[model samples]
Target: MKITPGTRSRATLATVAAAGAALLLLTSCASSTEPAPEAGGAVAEDCTPLHEFPTIQDGVLTVAAMNAAPKFHALSDSGPFTGIDATLIPEFAAENCLEVKFKPMTGAAAQLDLREGKSDMFGGLILKTPERAEVFAQSEGSILYETLGFTSAKDDAYATIDSLKGKRIGTLSGSYYVEPLKAAYGADSIEEYQSDSNAFEDLKAGRIDAVAWQSIQGFNFTDRDEDYVTEILGDEPAYPELTVLLENNWPHTKGNTEMTAAIDDYYERAKADGTVARVLTENKIGAQAADLYVNGR
Candidate 1:
């Protein structure tokens, strides 16, 4: 589905209403010994096994996410979570007869929440790195692919890494680009900011020569403000792919094999149905990167 802010708000409200009605119905019928019916009154036998998966709450899928925009999660004062992951989480929960709850956190804290059993999973755009794979099982089929690039106020081109030498660069703190940026430009020349907005602001103010971030993020910034421009870096097809994270241990993944499988199935279906592409396009999140990745695939 195309997930514009308005569409996302409406969809979230509908899902919340449906979940509330379901909860009330379940509560009123609590005196009966019969098992509660699944979301659609009947569950596929293949999907029935997913009911064995344990959640943070009895019938709720608690998710920990960072308030990143577009592809990840976005928070608004007057509306529910309104990004790709945010919208998808509730859809997944409702499909499995569960209510969804989101807890905002900082980067990497979402994964930590899953490890500590504080949340059922990390519902944000997380890279499927080898280090993370050792501790967490990733859902199949990445939801997004990152394209690395640099943003500058002067609309200058940076096609080669050697051109970045001796230049002051800004990157988001705790981002995957930090180590590589420091390695390329030396640690002293690299400045890390707590948020992308801060880094971009510094870039605009001439405090930094350029800002290193995802091409989509840089493009989004430039698209919003006419003062900056972005140039994609590196010869590689794309950066790392993003996936949902669940703890690898028994407490999270043991009986939840089908739950993970179901997620993978949903991703495949979403891709086949163009839901992923539509969301990316509607939000102007990662359209260029997604186009390249999809064409390459």
Candidate 2:
């Protein structure tokens, strides 16, 4: 059965709305009347058919995000959230004649917020799995492809999967990497943590031999800590692409085909005009994975 936001209780909606308003006050203190540059190097001038997609709060796009760095959203001490996904919000809101508000959340909670009407959308390096596709509508153009890898404090060679036979490995709980790593190594050889920060802590403290995560994330870690380094894994078989996701049954998405079409068009234009590539380059992430996905090698 297709679940819709209408199935949720009014009390739940009120709670979400109140929480979002509070967060908006705490975050995004700055506002700009001028829109960011779009794919064609021009600002959006009109939001035709704007009445079709109704936001949870009028004139605002509430986003649920995990405050992770590089590819996902990152919260600043006294400024707006900044990252690849967060950076896209201004242009998107401009095109839709809306202001942007960010709500901090992680993992399953972000998905829950979307379903409960706490947020309109969530984007933090989300992968488009078949299971998620059944409930949420993914962006038509991929934000980037993610390659998985292993990070370790030592310079030990990980030339083969067999190299990790008896070593302790850690990964984020509920990540797609868990099963594969467990199958390759034994269940007892792997440890799961609630977040990458926890896993990295174990790795740095020598509790785990390696931390398995996205290659870009691993790179981010190594960039910050000189003692650590990453090894890209599973080159013969590529990892899945990542994209931003919209709640399928939210009020803005319910029967709002035009808004969906406009979003897709924006992404397509961004891809065609090198906006995606430029963003990745500017942030110093996703270049290798992007090349691999585009060139098919």
Candidate 3:
């Protein structure tokens, strides 16, 4: 009996130690800093994937866009998941009583994702040729008027298409220039990559004679790396325009018919009332000198 009575104190001490250890474990797992999205992870939100709508709500519309540097700037600190088109899409969503959510994916992935119903839409699609019509559906709007060019090392000679004859021209695979360059110059003249960053890197290293890209991107590249230089080689001679893309019969996602129609109507009204021009002016996206429809492809 005396021995049994002595055992309770030891049991109490053991229990207290066990409780302290459990508390320490819990505390160790608690983070003082909030968890952030994993690298290249999509921003988590409570919304359906793709441009699908389970039920029409006076709420958010989730959009996925390409993280094409400078041009799309979808993840910039100034406005994370927001840029020119990023700004416009949400405004269009709001006018239709929908809130907007942005998701960023690679350029090519975003294209396929939109078709697979992973995103509602993707921006920054340049019309290099008419064949794009067979893929994603294009919107009634023109997003960017890209000025295609060839960038070079600052000291390199400014070359023309004719000058670049027989030279190795680096560009992105499936880019607007890929096919045309092959057609005009020859297949041997085109050296393509999945991402232009590597191509630009190689160009700077003298691995390629020239690199073709859009003017805006050229300026951005120069800003980032001093030795890099660029010049307008020529407009994509035959296919030189860019436009926004939508899902086929876009705004047709279930329960979104009304929402889509409203956007189309709003754009038409904005053009007629000049609200669109004012928006463009405020955004510094440059002015549309004429109706993009008539003057642009």
Per-residue lDDT of candidate 3, residues 1-297 (tens digit):
001111211100000111111100000111113221112222234433223333222344545555555444543322344234444454444334344445565556656665666655555434423555456544454433444556777676444567677788887775656676787678988888766578878888888987876544454465456565655433434433311211211222323444445545544555565554443443343222112311333
Q: What is the lDDT of residue 24 in candidate 2?
A: 28
**In model 3, how large is the Cα lDDT of residue 83?**
30
TM per model?
A: 0.71, 0.72, 0.60
Which residue window of length 10 is worst by lDDT in model 3?
8-17
CA lDDT, every prediction? 0.55, 0.55, 0.46
Q: Once model 1 is optimally superposed onto the true structure by TM-score, how far is the C-alpha of residue 92 displaced, in angstroms?
A: 2.0
Q: Which runs in model 2 stand beyond 4 Å of their true positions?
A: 1-52, 76-79, 234-259, 286-290, 293-296
What would the TM-score be for candidate 3 when compared with the true structure?
0.60
Q: Which stretches of candidate 3 lie over 4 Å from their true place?
A: 1-60, 74-79, 125-129, 157-159, 233-297
* Residue pairs that clash (backbone atoms under 3 angstroms), model 3: 59-99, 60-99, 61-99
- Give the deviation of candidate 2 from the true structure as CA RMSD: 11.6
Query: RMSD in angstroms, candidate 1?
Result: 8.7
Question: For model 1, which pairs clash?
Answer: none
RMSD of each: 8.7, 11.6, 20.6
